[model samples]
Target: MTLPLIHTPYAQVRQALLDHTEIALLDVREEDPFAQAHPLFAANLPLGRIELDAWQRIPRLDTVVVVYDNGEGLAERAVRKLQSLGYQRVSLLAGGLQGWRDAGGELFRDVNVPSKAFGELVEAQRHTPSLPAEEVLALQQQQADVVVLDARRFDEYQTMSIPGAISVPGAELVLRARTLAPDPRTRIIVNCAGRTRSIIGTQSLVNAGLPNPVSALRNGTIGWTLAGQALDHGADRRAGEVTPAQRAQAAQDARAVAQRAGVRHASLADLERFAAERGRTTYRFDVRSPEEFAAGHLPGFRSAPGGQLVQETDVSAPVRGARIVLVDDDGARAHMTASWLTQMGWEVWVLDGVDRSAFTDTGPAPATLPRPSRPVDWIAPATLAEQLANEAPGQTAVINLTTSANHVKRHIPGAWFVLRTDLERALSTIPSAKRYVLTCGSSLLAQYAVEEVAQATGARVLVLEGGNQAWADAGLPTAEGEQRLASPRTDRYRRPYEGTDNPREAMQGYLDWEFGLVAQLARDGTHGFQVL
Candidate 1:
């Protein structure tokens, strides 16, 4: 049965944020449109991905959820879907996106606005020091006493980095900086793909009271590129393990910083108490590296690398005012990460006294959801290839439900890229076929949509076993490009700093946007950010 629709006005939403009450302001539009404009706290959930992500993101069924769209007619459908999925308090944003504008709510552009805005605010309040890319390059040429640390993910550092820079990631900066540069006189330069991580990472070291002189590489790699500097590709330099004395000092400094930022510490018993709370939402994360997390981690703790968690808070914890519990075996990383989260208005806690014995779970966190009780019909990749070869042009329609970006990169040749939510409309556009084979990156999402497709078309539908990966593994012929797209490629937002081919103006524009975020935060007034 469909639940009654609830309308939550912009004023009420703003009040909720100001009160530090739990509320998930979700923009149920594709990422491209979502990145264009949204409220300060709005997280992009995307209407089509509700089933796949809703359970994991909004874990508590009773948590209040307000979904909106900019006249895309998606919010109403999203409410119904959430209700079906057992979410009890789903509502529509009263008046939608335009309503927020009508009520004078500040709308922010780009993804991860809360964290990015907080970074700018930190820089403004603390006047975080930085050096231009050209100056850093000149210092390198002169063989100055400087060590460059890239604060982005290892993969991002590998993609493009300052020549000879080491990948220390943001959370590792404070814990590993002293080990990387033993000399107190050594100048440390921090960078990322863009601005936020650089600013935050630099500020973290300064806040932690590191002896080395530190500064952010202004505008990060973007600044380097705009200054006509070439970046190193496939760089593999990384921070090494810290010595016992270094780890002890780093832990002491990190704990001091976290305490000043009003971060709390919780014992395992305290964590259990938090978990048992009936109405509140609590997110438990192991704030360690992926490899460390895979080796062993406490059960029920999802792995969220500390730096990425701080950089992508919206993606990790969409519920704005929820409680966050971070776990790490090394005392420094969790404490340092908690300091940032506390400053960003989270009621965050670092788990204390965790030993090796607490790590019971091993390997990566399982991505599987509860499978359907009814067995799903599936076709092997080779068999599907044979059927396609023997079948007529319109005998079978292969629908790919993977992300638009992945589909464009590689997929079974002739497969139509279609959004699962729009399957009914998509079926009408494709030529009538006797059978439909559905596939996604792993066929997980595709499995959920089989019944819907069958109901809509009354045709035989089967899932592609192991989806696109299995097809590729068999050395079957594949195709690339946007050759057969039934849906628009708006699932992923193209970052200005991602590739080498972005226009100079866009890169400069992105930097300009970052510069203005401090003022935007002032206008918003709901963000409870404090910089130490």
Candidate 2:
């Protein structure tokens, strides 16, 4: 039976934000759909991976939580799941997403709408100088002492970039810009896949008082592509580390910006107290590059590069209204990143005087602590092979719960790909069998559905021990491609920026979607932004 959903109207939700009340606005859908349309503050907590991330993302169990969906009936399901996880205060956004529209609420498009809108607003207010794609292309053609820098992730820069552009990511610009082009005459042009990062990055240099002539590539690579320009693929150019003097300048500039934004500097003792406080969630992030973080870093701090942290705050700190403390070996990155958080209406803090020698880790701490153990019946590969060889030929059924993409790649012979949600209806269609064996990539996912299957169909539902990996390791041959699918392939959505087979239409569609977010924010009017 579906559990009854507690509903909160858009008016009360909007009022909470206005009154500075603490609440988490969640969008429980896949990343792609969540990117297409969501509120400025709604965090995307996909239902498929909710079990893995919910605890770390939503640390305080008693915190007020509100979840919404695009009428997919996912909100109700998510509410029940959160309740099952011991969340005391949980409610669904009444009437799904449509209800928000009916109540005159604003709907935004694209992931990180808040950051993107902030960048756009910064440009509107500051009039941060920028040159259109046409002019930048001319400069590149002329080789007029211009150094192009991509402010997006390195992989994104490698995927598609302006010819001769170097990867300098967002926060790195302030620290490493001088060394890359020490000659003050060398004009600096910053770009990203789209407008936000480029705008934010260009403004960062301008705000830092860089001596070089700085300007954003108008609208970034999207505008470049739209202007019928070529993007270099598989480019490997990158920037080097900061010099001692450059580092000092970066630290001084960043601290000033953070102070101007009212971002407090917290000591180790202050952070300790914040962590120990009951009914409060505190996120400690090391705002440095992955390589720097990998060498050694703080014990509790996670590696979130300063640039990406500002761009994807929801992924970093899902608990809205929670205290955030950023750490970095170089004072620049953390303070610079925290400045953005402050303007974005977050209660952000920067750690001061931490010993760099104390840090000694490679990655962030696990999102959840000590996961609950759930037992799944063992189905060894050799035993399953013997069962498959039975004379009846249909006595035992093998169901794979891996992604459709993975199932299409390789799967056990005669295994039917199925979705956990559609397993009941799917079981009815499979040939009459004495037992049903469920497997995913590792059977971890299948284990969650095993008990439900037995309760519904009264069949002996056994989980494949070690799943397909064990089968392959046991020298069992597997099949390739989609042969049998018990459910439709609706579990995953294709990203426009993913893979190389693009028809140009999809890329343009993505840009068009981003172009509209500014207007959406205007209509929504609930975002409490104080641009610094």
Candidate 3:
């Protein structure tokens, strides 16, 4: 029997990436090659891993795997192994990374945070000198013609920056810098939290082959902090302004950038119209931190970090060819994200004014059908307790999904405190349940556990609301026995920078990028920032 194959062109690969479609971009090159630079969506499983453990990473036998490498040697081997593993459809990217690059396809740097990558572009270029706090003070005394461009986000700039520095985020610098420093030699200086963005910003101008000599504020605000320099937290201080004409121009520029990257922006009315009448599935993602999401989000919008949304659009949306609309306050986060999504191939839109109004739950109701279950599950304490007390005349079982600390303090009788992380491999221990209740800290995890188990064995499963806390809060009885076993140690809670090599490396890069944030905030003033 012949295996399914799809040999796609560089343009098609780029389009698949922009659409956020379910196309696995597997780079067969070794880790080091990938770290230097590769397609943004590409994951380096390496040729060895695929030959040995392709099934582990590429678990779904039916995933559309598109293999590529710098050249072609390893990819052919990968396709054979993938085919052996029952991956029904597998194909090679026609020209691989070289082809994409040769076609003038843009490549993404290994920037950790999606937002931070945007922050990297907001400063000037130069071979200018860095002034220590004392030197800057001295320069002030000397009445130097230097202007401090605070290359940080607006909010951070508002909190504190160099007293006289103006704001310009890294991504917007090229578009806004000329007006801010129209003169050829303005003695421009850039500063961020620690350094990366400031250095990158200054260097970007130099690389742009700009004539002005720019310099980064050495060590940025952190150096200021280390220098014991005082910060100005005064209210009513104005940041740089974005005129209406400038706003219009910026929107146009952003649109063009999006086009280059394949991102789309949609109005609220357009989104509403799509949602109101949809033959195709449409996912409304709130691309913000969980803290921001918990603070408030648009109704019916699921909280998916921008990178995660782009990376796991298949799992998040599941429905192929769904329309994706992302909500964020400004164009930086949305446009930058939209750029990646556009390359993926989904009908994508970035909605403005997401944070302007409170979320009104007036949209169509969620599908009432039960979600497909998985092999493992977690449940709440209250629901678990109820299920335990009223089980059938068989050996019913229950597992506690709480921390060791909480389990030691209190747990339901006869319930084993299994770490929710172990639920997958530990499923073998689950006795043929008259039923099993998976209890956890909250209903959220428990609900997921129930779904997982249901998918695996069609087990009768239930999750408790409020989890163990709810049970304890209800004055439920406790068993004070020492735990005979330890919970499984899982890194599920740690969200790593999902880029090149290990997550730690990605996170470190992200941190380095974030360190330069305070400076970017100051350079790009916050006039047009809408929190929604």
Per-model C-alpha lDDT, please?
0.91, 0.81, 0.57
Q: Give Cα distance to truth, residue 88, candidate 1, Å.
A: 0.7
- Give lDDT tens digits, candidate 3, residues 178-209: 55765767767777665555654554344333
What does each candidate score in C-alpha RMSD? 1.3, 3.3, 12.1
Candidate 1 C-alpha lDDT tens digits along 1-532: 6678999999899999999999999999889899999999999998777778888888899999999999878899899988888889999999999999999999999999999999998888899999999999999999999999999999999999999999998898888999999999999999998899999999999999998899999999999999999999999999998999999999999999999999999999998899889888999999889998999999889999899999999999999899999998879999999999999999999999878898989998775364543469999999999999997788889999999989999989999999875677877888778899999998988988888788888889999999999999999999999978988788888999887789999999999999999999999999998877
- Residue 254 local lDDT, model 2: 83
Candidate with more favorable, higher lDDT: 2 or 3: 2
Q: For each candidate, what TM-score against the reference?
A: 0.98, 0.88, 0.42
**Ranking according to TM-score, highest score first:** 1, 2, 3
Model 2 TM-score is 0.88
Candidate 1 ranges beyond 4 A from true positions: 367-375
lDDT of 2 by residue, 202-247 (tens): 9888877789999999877767877889889999998876789889
